[model samples]
Target chain A: AQSVTQLDSHVSVSEGTPVLLRCNYSSSYSPSLFWYVQHPNKGLQLLLKYTSAATLVKGINGFEAEFKKSETSFHLTKPSAHMSDAAEYFCVVSESGKLVFGAGTILRVKS
Target chain B: EPEVTQTPSHQVTQMGQEVILRCVPISNHLYFYWYRQILGQKVEFLVSFYNNEISEKSEIFDDQFSVERPDGSNFTLKIRSTKLEDSAMYFCASSFGQETQYFGPGTRLLVL
Candidate 1:
């Protein structure tokens, strides 16, 4: 069985500050990890993906996530937060053609 | 950059009525998928389609649910009997390969 756990249910950050959303996964084999963002009433948008090639993956909107095999973690981060960055983030893991998503973390950017 | 598209941004229906959610995948994509998210919940996979046939489906996909790619471009998910529990945001996604999938705007279904 493959699973993903997003640590924080909600994260608040002021504008121009750093942001972090934590995630951990359990997989028997190498898994494909992805970060997706969903704005209110909008579909999910892929931010970035990590196969086996790169441990550090860069995504859109100044977002990035690091895949740490030792800790089984893939945490999303941004150097600075913007109001537009407020959204629900999901950590997903894919194995054997199926995807398992985390509970999701709601990011709130305060101006 | 072609993207997937879905229709009926929102739908309100009575229980027991049938509803069909439509999606148009990116041209030249071979794989298609459907997922749903209940309010404040994780996104759950329903089914995956390839070669005009169902390649895989999750436990959430029951006999009451059926998927079809009736035309060359349109893919549809049909719910035989709508239930109150069926109210959620349904997303349609397509991928050229088995890698990253592009999603549509999604259709919000409200079964009353």
Candidate 2:
């Protein structure tokens, strides 16, 4: 069985400042990880994904995440936060081709 | 940029009434799915479909819930009877095999 844990339920970041949302996973096999963003009342948008290919994955809207195997973490990051970046973030893992999502992290960007 | 599309962006229903949510996945996509989010909760997988049959389903997809690809370009989820707890945002998603899944905006069902 595979599961994901988002370290924080909420995070606040100042506009133009750096943003970091932490996530860790537990899986029996080498897992596939993904990040999704959902704006208010909208569906989830795939941010990025880490297959067995790249350790550092780059996503849309200038976001990226590093797949750290030893630490069991796949934290999302962005160098500069924008008001449009304010939304809920979800860390997900895939096992047996099934996607299981974590309790999302709400990100608030303030100017 | 083709994506999954869902119907009835918002639906209000009474307890014990049946509600059906609809979806149209991207053309050529072979896999379809339904997921739900109770306000402030993690997205829960309800069911996955392929080849005109259910590929996988979670515990939450009880007897009250059923999925059908009754026609081309249409996939539907039918709730046999509604409960107050059933009020939530239901999302329809599709994917090409094991790759990333594209999601629909969701139908906000409010059971009153």
Best by DockQ: 1
Angstrom error at residue B35, model 2: 0.4
What is candidate 1's TM-score against the reference?
Answer: 0.98
| lDDT by residue (tens digit), candidate 2, A1-111 | 899999999999999999999999998878899999999978999999998898999999999999999999999999999999999999999876568999999999999
Tell me the tens digit of each residue's lDDT in model 1 across A50-83.
9998899999999999999899999999999999
lDDT tens readout by residue for model 2, B1-112 = 9989999999999999999999999888999999999987889889999999998999999999999998889999999999999999999999888678888999999999
- Chain B TM-score, model 1, reads 0.98
Residue-level lDDT of model 1, residues B1-112, one tens digit each, is 7889999899999999999999999999999999998987888999999998999999989999999998999999999999999999999999889988889999999999
Q: Which stretches of candidate 2 lie over 4 Å from their true place?
A: none
Model 2: chain A TM-score against the true structure? 0.98
What's chain A's TM-score in each predicted model? 0.98, 0.98
Per-residue lDDT, model 1, residue B45, is 91
Q: List the residue pairs that clash in candidate 1.
A: none
